[model samples]
Each structure stands twice: as C-alpha cells, then as structure tokens.
Target: MQRIGSLPSDDSSPGWFHTSRLRQPRPPLIGDAQAPWVVIGGGFTGLAAARQLALNFPNDTVILVEAQQVGFGTSGRNAGFLIDVPHDIGAPDYIGDQANAKNILALNQRGQHILRDLVEQHNIVDAQLRHSGKYQAAIEDKGIAVLNAYRGGLEKLGEKVQLIEGDELKEHIGTSFYRKALFTPGTMLVQPSALVKGLADSLPENVKLYEDTPITAVDYGQKTTLHHPTGRIIADKLILANNAFGQYFGFLQGRMLPIFTYGSLTRPLTAAEQASIGGKDFWGVIPADPFGSTLRRTHDNRILVRNSFSFNPDGRHKPGYTDKVRQSHRLSFERRFPTLTNVEFEHTWGGGLAMTRNGQGFFGQLRENVYGALGCNGLGTVRGTATGTLLANMLAGKNESLTEFLLAAPKPNWNPPEPALSIGVNFTLRTGQARAGLEA
Candidate 1:
C-alpha cells in the first residue's frame, strides 16, 4: 500500500479559474465503487486519458477522480499556449535534436488537432480556442540570440516562422520592451480553465467523473484499490495521469521534480486602456529565455503575466508565496505596458509543472496493470494530452505507432533526495532568473 504524501491545493486566486464560467463541480466519490478502468487526476492528462479510454472501450466503465474541482488545478493555471512544435523549455534553445524534435512536433500537433476538434464539436466558445499563433520575444541581446537559435531549429524542421521587430513588433504586441520576436502560426491560444472544463463536461458517457475526491491511499496489485475520505474505489487497471503527484503514489519518486510557476491577470482593460496599448486585441508572447516572463493580451481585454519558478518538492506552495510572486508579475507587466500603471491584477496563482532531470516525460506501464503518463516538463498542455491519449490507445491496442514512439521516449533521470536536491534546484533557478535580467 502506497500512502499519498499530499493532495493538490492551489492558492485562492487562480486567475483563469476565477474568470472562467465554471459550473458546480461534480460530487465527490462516496461509498464503495468499482470500475474496469480508473484514472486519477482531473487535469488535462487524466481527463484526456479517461475520455479516450471510454471511447476505446465503450462497454467498460471508466472512472476519473479529481482532488479539486475541474479547472481549478494546475491544468487551468497554465499560460494557455498549446504549442504544436518542439518547445523544450529545458533545452537551451527550446529545441532538441532534429529527429527527436520532429517526433515531438508530430505528437504535439496531433494533440492540438484533437483538442481543436473537441472545442469545435462541443462549441466551447468560452474556451476561446484560437489559432492566433504566438510570439517568442527577446528583451536583451542574449535573449535575441536564443530566439535566433530557436528560429534556426524551426527552420530545420521546415516550419514557417516570421521575424518581427522594432515598430512592427510593437504594433502587434504593444510592447517596446521586446527587441525582436519570432512568430509561429501553429500554436493555439486558449482559456485553459474553460478548455479543461469543457473537456470534462463533454467526456464520453461511459466515463464517470468525480470531482473534489482526493485519493488517500492506493493498494496496487492485480486489482488496484484506492481509498478516499468517505469511500474507496477498486479497479481492474489504473492509469496515473496526475503528473507530479504521481511521486506520492510511489511511482515517480526521486525522478520527477515539482516546479511551481506563477501567473497574474489584470482586471479587464477599459476602452481607454486598450487604446493606450495600441496592439492586436489578443496576442501571447513567450520569452526567448526559458526563465523569462510570459505575457498575454486576452480576447476580453485583460493582460496576463507569468514568470518565476520555485522547486516545491512537496507539491504545494509556502505561505505568502503567491503574494511575493505577484510583485514580480507587477514589475513584468509595468515594464511592458507602462501606460497601464493603474490596471491592477485581479488574480494571482501558482501552478505546478512536472519536470525531470533529463528533460524527459514518463509514459508506459509502471508495474503490472498500472500505467502512467507523467512529467510533461513545462509543456504540459499539449504533451500531457498526447501522452494521455497515447496511453489509452496503447491499453486498447490501437495507434501502435504512436504508442511505440512514446514507449521509446527517454525516462526521467533520478535525483538526489531532499535538502541537496532542493539546494541545487534553487541555485539553478536563481541563476537562470538572474541571467534573464530585463526579460523577467
């Protein structure tokens, strides 16, 4: 029996979740329940896994359990860029080896298409899923060098990219802070909370979703039994899609690192404020430096600033952490839109990213009938979806090619325990942030 060390909980002010049109969450699991297939976590990966399992095995009941309400966890707290290309934030240039990069692009593009179709089919207008593309902007010469290197990688992949700079770049993003930018039309922007909620609500009939039910313990055997507060669940097979939390289940322990990143969203800009910025109504910018800030102008006239990373080994933030990060966000926001000094952030929150020492994600059978799709590094939105879907397909004996590809993907490297690990990670993060300079 593996005891879950901790449950997922977020700060009170998740910008995306609070702003989204959220329905009442489903009731928690109560009493005893049994299912042929069970998936833990309500985030993108678990939702995708459960949905696919239902589609693949329509006759079998699939149960999905969430520790919190849908759209209120890490999945909903991202910067909302569904990148379709190789976006390895851990890599120096945000791209890997050419062949590996190509494979990643193919998988991520497939994930994007799957999500796009779901958004359209469900008419999830609130999700604001748009092919608006994204800008990779650089604020310093070093940052620009990184962007140029990234551009070269994209060119090698035969991907289309446009370089925007000076007045033209300002015309599009309303930010003179960036010296130059590379725009790629393939990335999709979304209201992440709405998209995840929509996916949950549109899950297949055979899949049962239970929100606000945190599993307390798990006994893994031929039949897996999960214990929650008020009830227990037994399943013939299990898929762990909980990402960083997978460590608590004794699955990815000593391998996955739970890194938390923060985001702040300003209250909607008034007409005057919008005109003052003088750019496209909705545009998203990813920093050229991996540790730099991410800025987005929402369709509804709000701005989002996301930056700062902390190595939270226990999978939770310390007291007052979000407040401190909000200050950093304010600086980033003011640096970009100096005219919007009066526009205050309405919400600030932190979200966890499951990273690995070797910059790889886990996807395969863990032990016996237990399988997992964990560690999305920093590109969880697309990578999580792709791996989760592939995990389901693999279980159902479908999409063998993609399944084999995922199986062949490298596993996360092991890490030293506790104090030593935390010290090293913190030093690395601080150094990266310091190097980011004005980009942060």
Candidate 2:
C-alpha cells in the first residue's frame, strides 16, 4: 500500500544530539534485497528489535531501515528519564492499581537492565548512562496533592520512595519554586539520541542497517514487500516500530493520538552561572502534574527544559510552531531560575509521542505474519524499549515470564477522527495547563 506519512526531517527540529560528536553515516537502500525479517524505523524500538532478531535467528538475515538517521526522530528527542514506575500522562496522579503498578515497575526495570548491558559491553559513551534516581517536583498545592497521592500509591505497591519538602526540595533542585518532591530510585538518566545510536552501532552482524531511506510503500502478504526510493526489500516477516507514524500506515489509526511535545537545551552553563544556580552538579525532575514542565541538569552543565504539548494530527509541525515553543521554554526557564539571568537555550525541538486513550499500546500480532509495537503513551524511554524487546521475543515464540503479562495488557481504545479529535485534544491540553498554573 502507498505510504501516508513523510520521513523524519531535521530541518525544523534541530536538537542537541545533532551537535554531538560526528558519526559514520550509513547509506540508504540502493538495490533489491531479500531478508528473513525486515524492521522499519531506526529508533530505540527498531534497533532493539533488529538486535534481538539477529541474535536469536543467526542463520537468517535482517534488514533495518530508517527514514532519517538514528536518533533523529522521537527516540533522540526525549528528556532522558527511564522511569520504572506507573506514569500515565493523562491522569492527575501517576500511580494506579496495585497489581498493575508492580507490573509497570518490573517491566521497566527489565528494559533498563537490558539497556545497561548494551551500554557497558559496547562501551557506548554517547549514552552517558547514569543509574541516578529521578525527582518529581511540585510548585502548587494541587501539584503537591498529586505527589502525595503518588507517594501513597507507591507505598501500597511496596516501592521505595523518599519524600522531600520545603528546604530539602529546594536544596536538591536549587529551585525554591517547588514546595515538595518525591525521589524514586529505580528510574535512570541517559543521553537519549546517543543511546539509540550506540544500539544501532552495536547490532549483530546479521542485521543490515539502512539510513536515510524512507519506505514509500509496503505490500503485505505471505511475503511482505517494502518499497523505497532507490530499491525494495522483501522479507518473510515484518515488525513495525515506527511509533506515531503508525497511524498513517492504516495501523492504530483510530486507536492512537499522535501528540507533539517540545523541549529545549541551553548552552552549557558558564562557571559563574553554574555556581549561581547551584544544587547538585547534575539532576533531572519530572513535574508532579503530567502536563507541567520537565527539567534536567546535564552532566555538561546545560539545562534542558520540556513543556508544552499540541495535537499534531499530521505528525508534522509548521516552522512557526517551534519558534513559539522556544518562547515558552524561555519563559519557563526564567520563571524557575531567576538567578541565572544570562542563560539562553541553544536548541529547541519537538517530537511525536503516540498516546492511547486507555494509556496502553499495540504490542502483539496485528496480522498473520506482521507483528507491531508502538504507542508508548508518553513514557517512551523505558516503555518503548521494553515493548520493542518483547516484540522480538514474541516473533521468535519465546514466552519469557514478562511476555504473557505484556501480551495481555490492555490495548488502545478507539478515538474519533479529525475535527472531533482536534477539538478534544486541544481542549484537554489547555485545561490541564491552566490547572497546572505555575507547575506548567
């Protein structure tokens, strides 16, 4: 069938990952090729699937295609918190049912463990993997209430968490704007784009990676055919890892909402600037309200800020949208760090997040020979990785302990089409931000 969405372009959303060290380029598809399995999209999910497929079926060949370079898409644009707890972005509080909360923790920890091995064995310096816990901070009373509810829920699940209030919270974040915070030890921090690139670079020899190659069309049958600009690929099995773009391909169209979230990274802080806004050298915080801003202090001393969400039905943004987001980022930065008056954001970008109405995703066989995994519901880092790894195992018929739990997890609920979707999503976002107030 003909493709519906465009390839990921770097023109509009240039991020800090692009400014990082140079990487060896991989050529796009140039000729016809046949493989036992073909995976589309080169982000965390696709790379993980390709790696597992190659390792499990060593005798068979696998081809992985990327519309843009690895990490140029959603995988690379995230704020880099690998959360290992319940995080439903649409809800007031992140916690949920006791049994399900435990499952969420186990599933995320499983994904992080796998990623830790890859980072260590491959010596992926770009990942900058750190096992540091994450902080959830709240400025308003409503946000503080959310944190309290979350803490209570975590206690019910028997998860370890530390509550910080007043002076303690200020000392930890170097910001008196927050009145309370919660520290969850299982979460991790990493440089997202680098992690995806490292995984792609360390893939097994049996996997052939093609970058800058966008799939123009795909005809599915007993043998699926993928058509690109320069060539075509025929594989016996197919795995779809393109998250938000899945809607355009007649998969998860009515079941997922493709939301665009914006983030900006500041130029590395000067020595004086760092001292002026001092707390810990590096730290990350998630807002108590899901709609509030997410902040991070990079090891290199740069401050990264993420806030603002819009429903981009087409999965593409007008240039003006990004400029507006940068302005919002600047306002948020100035509000929280008045002491660092001269700080400026060097890069601002937006990425697609596939969210489902029920906070679940598509994670099993959608067709006879086609398996799919996407719709991370805004927790893409750990959720995407865990689901991607499970996709590979499911294809290979490996029923590990977590496989059954994931397979049986709730699926995405159907959503309305354009006019209604546009209206509802925008209204909800605006209402949330309004309620979040300064937290936003």
- Taking all chains together, each candidate's TM-score versus the true structure is 0.98, 0.97
lDDT of 1 by residue, 327-427 (tens): 99999999998888999999999988899999888999999989999997989898888888989999998866667788897789999877899999999
RMSD of each: 1.1, 1.5
Q: Lowest-scoring 10 consecutive residues by lDDT in candidate 1?
A: 87-96
Q: Report how far residue 136 has shifted in candidate 2, in Å.
A: 0.4
lDDT by residue (tens digit), candidate 2, 1-440? 86756555543455657755567858898989999899988877888889988988999999999988887788889999888887654444466566676778888887888888899999998788887899999988888888888888777778899999887777777887788889998888998988888888889999999998888888878988888898789989888888878766668878888788999998899998877766888789999887899999887888999999988776665567888888888888999999876887888998888888888888888786788888878887777778788889878888876778888888889898778888999999989877778987
Q: How close is candidate 1 to the true structure, as a TM-score?
A: 0.98
After the best TM-score superposition of candidate 2, give how far the Cα of residue 320 lies from its true spot, in angstroms: 1.9
The lDDT of each candidate is: 0.90, 0.83
Residue 384, model 1: Cα distance from true site in angstroms: 1.0
